[model samples]
Target: MPKDVYVDQDECTSCGQCADNLPEVFAMDDDDLAYVVDGGNTAAGEDAIQEEIDQCPGECIHWKE
Candidate 1:
């Protein structure tokens, strides 16, 4: 099974880096905060998602435990 990914919206900087890095798992809401895309393929795999988390300037992306 793939790990789930989530964004701490409060900590989001509206930078759109997560979405740009992995649109399959991340998106920007109207508020421009990064969110885990609904019904999207989080199955892009852990390393891919983690890359976004690591690259996120806001440091808001995380694996959902």
Candidate 2:
């Protein structure tokens, strides 16, 4: 199964990189913080998502356990 992804809102910096890079899986909320879209295509694969996580300025994105 694919690993699930999420954003730690408390740690989010509202950078918008994840949304900018992967709109299909991430988006900015009304608060301008990044959030994982519901029913997002996690099948976009781990490497792609991990790249965003690695590049995120806030480092708020993570894989769910």
Candidate 3:
């Protein structure tokens, strides 16, 4: 099954790692916080997204259960 990605803005550091590593799925909003894009929730970019989640300094990215 596919997973849904979410970002906790309160814990986000605005580091841009997620956006940089997976632009198709993540992007930096005007507030500098990382957010999941329209097509972000899926298995298509799961590996790359997981990489970002693993390396996220803020540890704000997560797979929605």
Winning model by TM-score: 2
lDDT per model, in order?
A: 0.81, 0.88, 0.87
Which candidate wins on lDDT?
A: 2
Sorted by lDDT (best first), the order is 2, 3, 1
RMSD, every candidate, angstroms? 1.3, 1.1, 1.4
In candidate 1, position 23 carries an lDDT of 83
Instruction: Please write out the lDDT profile of model 1 over residues 5-53, one tens digit for every residue.
Output: 7899999999888788778888899998888877554448778887887
For model 1, how many clashes?
0
Kindly report which residue pairs in candidate 3 clash with one another: none
For candidate 2, which ten residues in a row score worst on lDDT? 37-46
Model 3 over residues 1-65: C-alpha lDDT tens digits? 66898999999998898888788888999999999988777635678878888999999999888
Off by over 4 Å in 3: none
